[model samples]
Target: MKLLMVGAGLSGAVIARRLAEAGHRATVIDARPHIAGNCHTERDPETGVLVHVYGPHIFHTDDAEVWDYVTRFETFRPYKNRVKTTARGEVFSLPINLHTINQFYRKTLRPDEARAFIAAQADTSITDPQSFEEQALRFVGPDLYEAFFKGYTEKQWGCHPSALPASILKRLPVRFNYDDNYFFHRFQGMPETGYTAMVARILDHPNIDVHLDTPYAPGMADRYGHVFWSGPLDGYFGYDLGRLGYRTLDFERFTETGDWQGCAVMNYGDPEVPYTRITEHKHFAPWEDHAGTVCYREFSRACGPDDIPYYPIRLVEEKALLSDYAARAAGEEGVTFVGRLGTYRYLDMDVTIREALDTARAFLSGGVERGVAGVPG
Candidate 1:
């Protein structure tokens, strides 16, 4: 069978590789010049620092199979995401851990004491929270919420926390202990060389043909037995039912000699600050040493027609439009929606790869017919 994989990112690459290995010829096409999509990484010519072209992506997951699969292509170095934040004119550890709690309140409270204190601070009056603001207030109280999350959330989503759903804040943890690791995943690391190199290896199968800078066109799927689209779900339908809302990022890149920031990610929790976070590229790969450093000051905004969509803003209005597109996608023949954009959800790197593997397995096993790989829930 001849298969077509659209948008040669992690989803397309992983699925294409699996199908190719199963004695099926796969052709992968990417609109971007590079294959890794948002995960693309390249070394800066002048600074010699490996820059994460689309932002910092730390591969952290509890899935052992996904970890083993990625390790086959590239060596992964030991990496833990210890995120820091600047709030109220002071630097603090993220995730609202014990250290952060004590430092912010200027008290040397133990784990139990801190937990009790935070519990007392929480608004027990609000039994069930609906919005992000209510969720934070009910859990961490106003002080921590305002100092850390309020400003950052507003800047990232371009809306008041009250307008957003509580599910957003539910993902973030408020640890009582001193563990400052951003993610609680068992396995956490980064590709030794870069994500692009790792993806290149994944696409290096004999039965797979990769074409870059090729955009998907109407009737392109006519020649192939099946099509796996990882591009925007609305884009596949020419956004006929109106475009789904998304939040895009604008990166302000700068180069400096010597170490600029000691940490890999430094988020600004002050709403007054224009940018949300600053990432030091060299710190992402601690194994490699470079005298010069490269950094990106990231700012998030509403995605326009011409902009590269990052986060899907699934508000009530967007959800209605998404439903229409999803229904249209379900009826489409010989096509399966895959990955974040296709499913219209925010997906981590590990989840994306895992879903891609499962999609390929289902197709190979003859379990999936058409438009059933990754449909929006």
Candidate 2:
């Protein structure tokens, strides 16, 4: 069978490779000149520092199979994401750990003492929380919420925290212990060379043909037995039902001699600051040494027609429109929606690859319908 995989990122590459290995020819196409999509990484010519072209992506997951699969293509160096934040004219550790709590309040409380203190600070009166603001106040109280989350969330989503869903804030953790690791996954690391190099290896199969800078067109699926669309879900239907809301990022790049910032990610928790976070590219690849450093100051805003969509803003209105699109996608034939954009949700790289593998397996086992793999029901 001849298969078509749209958008040659992790989703398309992993699925295409699996199908190609199963004696089926696969053609992968990406609109961008690069193959890895947002995960693309390249080195700065002057400083020789590897820069994450889009933003910093740390591969962290507890899925052993996914970890093993990626390691087959490229060597992964041990990396832990220890995020930092600047708030109220002070630097603090992320995830609201014990150190952060003590530092912010200027008290040397133990783990148990800190937990009780935070519990006391929480607003127990609000038994049921509906919005992001209420959720934070119920858990961490106003002081931590205002200093760390309020400004950053507003800047990232372009809305007041009170307008957002509580589920959005539920993902973040408030740690009572001193552990400052950003993620709680068992396995966390980065590709030794770069994500682009790793994806290139994944697409290097005999039965797979890769074409870059090629946008998907109407009737392109006519020639193939099946199509896996990883592009935007609304885009496949020409956005006839109106466009879905998304938050896009604007990165301001700068280069400096010597180390600019000691950390990889330094988030600004002050609403007054224009940018949300600053990432030092060289710190991403600690194994390699470079005298000069490259950094990106990231700003988030609503995605326009020509902008590259990053996060799907699935507020109440967007969710209703997404349901309409998902229903339309279910009725389509010989096409499966299989990625973050296609499914209209935020996805990590590990989850994307895992779902891609599963989608390929389902297709090889005779499930080629639109709603088989990742389509929302």
Candidate 3:
């Protein structure tokens, strides 16, 4: 079967490669001039430091199959994301870990002691948490919430923490132990040659043709047996119903000598700071050494029509709009929606790859119509 894969990111590349290997022809198109979407990484022209063009992406997952699959394209060096935060003119460990708790409270407490201390600080008044603010208050209490989350949440989402759902904040762990690794996953690493190269390799097959800076038009789907869309769900229909909500990132790039933050990611938790975080790109690939550094100060705001959407703000209104779009997508006979934008959900790299692989395999086995994330069979 001939296939059209839109957006040459991990999703499109993985899907196209799989289908191509199965004796199917695939034509992959990306609006951008790159293969990896937000995971595009390149070396800074002057500094010679590896830069994550969109933002820093740490590849971490518990799934062994996914990890092994990624390793086939590029070798990954062991990299644990140790995030930092600046609050009230002080630097502290992220994920509200034991050191952060001790440093913030100015007390030396062991794991058990810290757990007890935090429990006492938690608000017993709120038995059932509903909002992000309420969940933080009940789990980490007012002081920690105000110090670590409140201002940051407001700045990142451009709204009050109370307006956000509890599920958003609940995913972040508040650790009692001394472990400062941001993610709790078993396998965590960064690609040696970077994500773009990794994906380019994935799309390197005889039966696959890649077209850069080419956007898949509505009429293009008619040329192929099936279309696997990884672009924005609203974009597929040109926003016929209504535009969904998303938070886009604005990066302020700079070059510096030596280290900038001495860490990969540093969150500015204070609302006074306009940008949410600063990332040192060189730190992302610690295995490689460089005298110079490349960095980006990231700012988050509501996504516009011309801007690339990053985080999907699946608010109540957006969910209603997504449902309408999904219905329209279901009616389309030879199209499958996969990946973050297609499904209108924020997805990690592993989850995106997993879904793409599944979607491709389903297609190869004559079950192309059926898929996860409302892809009708």
Query: Which structure is stronger by lDDT: 1 or 3?
Result: 1
Measured against the true structure, the TM-scores of the candidates, in listed sequence, are: 0.98, 0.98, 0.97
lDDT of each: 0.93, 0.92, 0.90
Q: Estimate the lDDT of model 1.
A: 0.93
Give candidate 2's TM-score: 0.98
Off by over 4 Å in 3: 370-377
* Tens digits of lDDT, candidate 1, 236-263: 9898779999999999999998899899
lDDT of 3 by residue, 1-377 (tens): 88899999989999999989999999999999888999999989998888999999999998888999999999999999999999999999998899999999999999999999999999999999999999999999999999999999998888899989998997899898888999999999999999989998999999999999898776898899888889988888898898999999999998889998899999999989999999999999898889998889999999998999999888778878887888788777788888999898888999999988888888878877622294322
- Over 4 Å off, model 1: 372-377
Model 3 weakest 10-residue run by lDDT: 368-377
lDDT tens readout by residue for model 2, 1-377: 99999999999999999999999999999999999989999989989998889999999999999999999999999999999999999999998999999999999999999999999999999899999999999999999999999999999999999999998988889898999999999999999999999999999999999999999988899999999999999999998999999999999999999999899999999999999999998998899989899999999999999999999988989988888898888888889998889888889999999999888888888865675233355
Cα deviation of 76 in candidate 3 (Å)? 0.2
What is candidate 3's CA lDDT for residue 184?
Answer: 94
